[model samples]
Target: MKKVLAAVLAGAMLTASMAGCSGTASSSSSSKAASDSKADSTAATSTASAEDEALTCTLNVWGPAEDQAKDKGNWLPTTCEQFKKLHPKWNITFKYSACSEGDAGKTVTQDPSAAGDVYFFANDQINTLISANALSELGGSTVDEIKSSCSKEIIDSVTVKDSVYGVPFTTNTWFMYYNKSKFSDTDVKSLDAMLKKGKVAFPISNSWYLPAFFIANGCTMYGDKGTDESAGIQFGGDKGTEVTKYLATLVANPNFKNDADGSGLAGLRDGSISAYFSGSWDAAAVKEALGSNFGAVSLPTVNIGGSEKQLKSFSGSKAIGVNPNTKNPQVAVALAKYLGGADAQRSHYKLRSIVPCNTEVLKDTDIQKDAMVTAQNETFEKTSIIQPFVASMKDFWTPTENFGKALISKEITKDNAASKVEALTKAYKNPVS
Candidate 1:
């Protein structure tokens, strides 16, 4: 299959060159004719080299059930079909199966050889996937095309050690979802103001959302950008304790609610909650519940130590990765690229309402008009912080969750906030030890 595609590409290049020479033949000098002939020869040689590197193999692909379902215009199967058309002789048979993006990293790490040749996963898994030697690095034209096609932040999310390890499909992060009828535009900008209007459901017990408070107070998880595993936890000292005390106050407010389940969505639907903190995954349901009253915006600022600080949500991306252990490594990489490419991303947007990461797709006027997409873009630009992909980050979730729960439960207070912060910092810095 690869050879056939190569031959066809080579023929096309040579034909185009020959046609150009024929058009100029009557006016061309001997030197000019020789130069054109040389150019043609170069084209043929490059095509031959590319053909030699072309891949021919069946690939196993994994993604969410919705992305693989035939009825949903699943991008995986559609992408595979399109890829096969481009590489006619390539005997590319894709075995599609169910695997959520969140589980892909752990699955690949557990058994690289048995994992899918191409799989969808969250960006936070890059460090662990690379450490397990489970992901393949993209190179050559593929890497170039990816860099040209996606946003800089999207590209950076999948890049490790200056090499791209995956192709980003969609951004996976939280923005603010609120009931417009309950709170005005100005009301939503201040967390304190929103709380006064009605109950606001935020999963304060979850580590994912808990960091927003500390981040607003200028606390960091690891060193700069969450890299440098050796740097350990920086969520201590004055800023950390200050944020902790503030959170203790917020949780004590009657309008503050802790909900980890779909209860928040239920609250929105029942008109009991004015606003909530969550991502695009809940956009559809919230839209349905609020109808014309639906409003999505960037996270609001919160009062901290007598000053208001912008709440910074953790930002991430969902991407497609090639397994390093695949028998057809090149084919796997190609498949990963195809799944996250422009066409596939557009399809994802139309079918799933997923905000595409592809630069061209994002520029589409219709995509730009989407409220969710616009709000998310604004959030990423103004208030989002990149979630680190380092291995040490694995230690952050449990300790942070415990700390958040303790604060909400009234077990940690202003007087004891410093000591508790110190102990949690020590545990986070030496999780395994």
Candidate 2:
């Protein structure tokens, strides 16, 4: 991933710099046009109206270490400068530090006032932020603009109870990373085919990856959006048992390896493993291991009910949220919007190699040319399921992993699969207090 990150960063910087020049030229032409046009008076009136609504405030922001680092492109500062240029009346001063997206909710929940007015957070943290009243709801023109600018999935991921809570900047998900030398293009399309080549590493016992099986076989976790706690676990049903039986067969296969201890990379490096299911986080290491043979694609299809079913993986987004406790809620909301907007998402893709969630940015020819970004985008579009962000989902991980372990140990057979699944479902339904 870092290989692509460096490559994309170089390209993105060039693209951004060129775009900056183009923008300056466009602004100059617009000034000439304004001087010559009769509509100049109307445009001036509109500009004045916008300025009247403009705000003035200092915004303390939080994001990952990369966003804060000067040498790493300092994306936040650049974005703020662009935003300030658009709304010059908004006297936004930013004080930023390293705060992981996953940690934003906890920090705000613990001390709302001290938390940054705007912060980047993971989509899964939405429910927690909402429950704690730590997030401000975006409304009116802001909501309309976001809905128009981003993909539906991106918009839907941050919306709760018909209110948008976060501005999604990039998608976060997993896909298959394989060694092209070991498997041909056709061979990588099916799980069974990949397994036939050599050992394929996946964390089958981990709750995060385990849900893919049940989900592909028509199971629901929590509810449609994972908000209905009463919906319980639907994986224990007939469809789930069928999927479990199929997974048991693979678990029993000698080519299957559990990646619980993080040995998969070592195995790949030493030629003991040919493929693994993971996300962008593992890209740099895996690229070094496979070198020229490294290849990434969507997850392979699994055999279910005598037919091939596309293997589904969970999808998530890293988003920007406004603190409800901010002194200037409107400006904070505007800043959050600007951070997740098309230009910001493009900058993020260039600076951090993060997959942009903005629809227009995703369609960029440059972004489409990057194999890693293209593969991830396609996989999320066709084969990924949105992971629920509901608070009740906190109870799901442990019991699901336990169930996976039991299956791997040959404790869940075709005959007894239903019973074990039922037990696991019961556990998941009963939230951990």
Which candidate has the top score in TM-score?
1
| Local distance difference test values of all predictions, in order | 0.75, 0.74
- Which digits, one per residue and each the tens of the lDDT, describe model 1 over residues 1-433? 4323433444454444333421322332322322222222234222444334333456788888887776767766877888777655445677887989889878878887678878889999988887776776665456677789877887888888787777888888888888887899899899998898889999989898888888898887666677767767777899998988888888889998887777788889898887888887777778899999889999999999999999998898899887765555434555566778888888788877788878888999999888899888888767988888777787888998999889888999888989998888887865442
Worst 10 residues of 1 by lDDT: 32-41
The count of backbone overlaps in candidate 2 is 2
What's the residue-level lDDT of 103 in candidate 1? Answer: 90
Looking at model 2, residue 322 earns an lDDT score of 76
lDDT of 2 by residue, 1-433 (tens): 4223423343233223222321322433322221212111122112454345444456688888878678878888888888778776556677786789978878767876578878999888888987776776665455666788777887888887776777888878888888899999999899898888788988988888989888887788777766677776688778888887898888889999988888788889999999888876567678789989989898888988888888888897888887765554445666777788888888877876778877778889998876678678777888888888766687788988898898878888877877888788788665443
Against the true structure, what is every candidate's RMSD? 10.1, 11.6
lDDT of 2: 0.74
Task: Please report the candidate that would top lDDT against the real structure.
Answer: 1
